[model samples]
Target: MKLNYKEDWPLYLIVLGVITMIAKEAVEVVLTPSKKMTSETNKNEWHQPSLYLDNELKGADREMVLYGENLIANTSYYFGPHGTIQPITNGMNCQNCHLQAGARAWGNNYDAVFATYPKLRDRSGKLETIASRVNDCFERSLNGKAIDTSSKEMQAIVAYITWLGHTVKKGDKPPGSGITQLPYLNRAADPGKGAVVYAEKCQTCHGNHGEGVAEGSGYGYTYPPLWGDHSYNTGAGLFRISRFAGYIKDNMPFNQASHQSPALTDEEAWDVAAFVNSQPRPVKDISHDWPDISKKPVDHPFGPYADGFSEQEHKYGPFQPIADARKVK
Candidate 1:
């Protein structure tokens, strides 16, 4: 007997639905492995925490944090050659070195400052406070005299640094808190090779003579001078080849690079640091630095080291030998 087609339509539809469900299950099985891999990769990544000073923050704490961030981001505006406030420092802001007021990861950030200070430092050879550390930068890096630690500006700066590291517990140094360390080269870094890299990659912003670009108002530098009377003095941390090279490896060419994807090779970073440091800049009296010569870093760039290496060897590398000698001792 022939079936009635309209009466059988619902039965046909149910069979079609069952076939569609089986096909979807087969497709999911094919995609499952790739989806699991993506989730695993995402779970392993780490990021620097965001800093906030919004409405939730109030009273003097908020004021201090806000002013501190402003001071760091605009240090040149308040303290540079033609500054409205002090006019004492070379025309470079704290952010020029600290990068994003010390919030950026592996960008010379202050992520460990609050947790680590009030501790003994090898450079100073004394128990130091956060305020003393800030003044150290003022004296050495800014090529200027120190401000009073009790002053509003100083307090604000300390407060901001503390706020940035609030999530970190005392005695714990979080990942990405400081400069990214690059491996040492087997041979001495070459100034001549660095000069070539500077001309090709750095000169457009930092200038042919390393005399960085000036702001329109003529008060501070838009791009900080790498070497000059207006640049950081000889006692600056960046005067060291290793420190400078690591800094360039993570952040350089003025925002063209990052820790995740650096623009310069390790050798190029070392060479460029050597070239920049070889240029003329203001000198600083560092007789008091590293009170114990034995405690001096392998790349201290000065004589009187416990190891008998020449000053030239100390400034540029093959620094692994010096480090090895220290380890043996």
Candidate 2:
């Protein structure tokens, strides 16, 4: 046998494959930390909080805006069961839902509020003022009674939202003003799979029962409940899987998650949304919602829809069909 290199091709191939594997692992080990550190370094480069501190803005107006921010950041402190401000909310901070007191980008921010207000909302089917918007949150998201429009607390919140949008022109819609949406799934999200995700990632903060984690001796929560009496009502935006999925994909697992580095895959986000919505929470009357059924979202979750899909389909979906059929019409 005269050193037949061709006949030994299989051995050469195996050696090459082994070398390639080692090279890839080595590259990964060296580069992964470097990439992560670079990302960490650039974290502060994004937009600042755009805060107006007391020193920068003095007087009664400044105090009111700060109080408004406080109301949003700690709703329970001034408005919970122990609250001296008349106790309107169900012991959850507005920041619990708003995320960073409506400062964080794509965290259901209030940047568009000042400009977009007095606009028609399909849900209400009328032009709603900022006061109406705030009251809407109280009635549904907070599962609490509406605040009087002229009340000092309500005025403070409106002032804060107004200040948040101060830089933008009246008619201009600011980017990153609200929760960013995720691409619709081709199939229904799986609640069973979501249960596993919730256990591994969410249950620690939201609690094993989805009842939330209370902070200190006060009624406020460190992490708001995903479901139960204290959480947003069934009629809240979070009750819709479409809204909830986007919310989780952008912001979940507390500080460890964001839109840039979504800890959960799209599948995980959808599944977790399904799991959360399937749980029990307080209900609100939505008899007047979607006054024009044709204008309703594909994921509205309640029916008699304009299309023929079942209520279950609306709740958990491959919603492309519904959207497509509507588009054709």
Specify the highest-lDDT model's number.
1
Number of backbone collisions per candidate: 0, 0
TM-score for every candidate vs. truth? 0.85, 0.84
Q: Every model's Cα RMSD, please?
A: 6.7, 6.9
Tens digits of per-residue lDDT for model 2, 1-329: 56568888888889999999999999999999978976774553224235544355568878888889988998888878788786877888888888888888768878778877879999889889998998899888988889889999999999888887776667765545677678888898889999999999999989999988898877689888889888999888888898889889888888898777778988899999999999988889898998998888888888878888888889988888888888898
Q: Write the per-residue lDDT of candidate 1 for residues 17-106, one digit (tens) a residue.
A: 999999999999999898887666445422445545355678889899889999999898888887787887887888888988888877
For model 2 the TM-score comes to 0.84
The lDDT of model 1 is 0.87
Q: Among these predicted structures, which one has the highest TM-score?
A: 1
**Candidate 1 local lDDT, residue 99:** 88
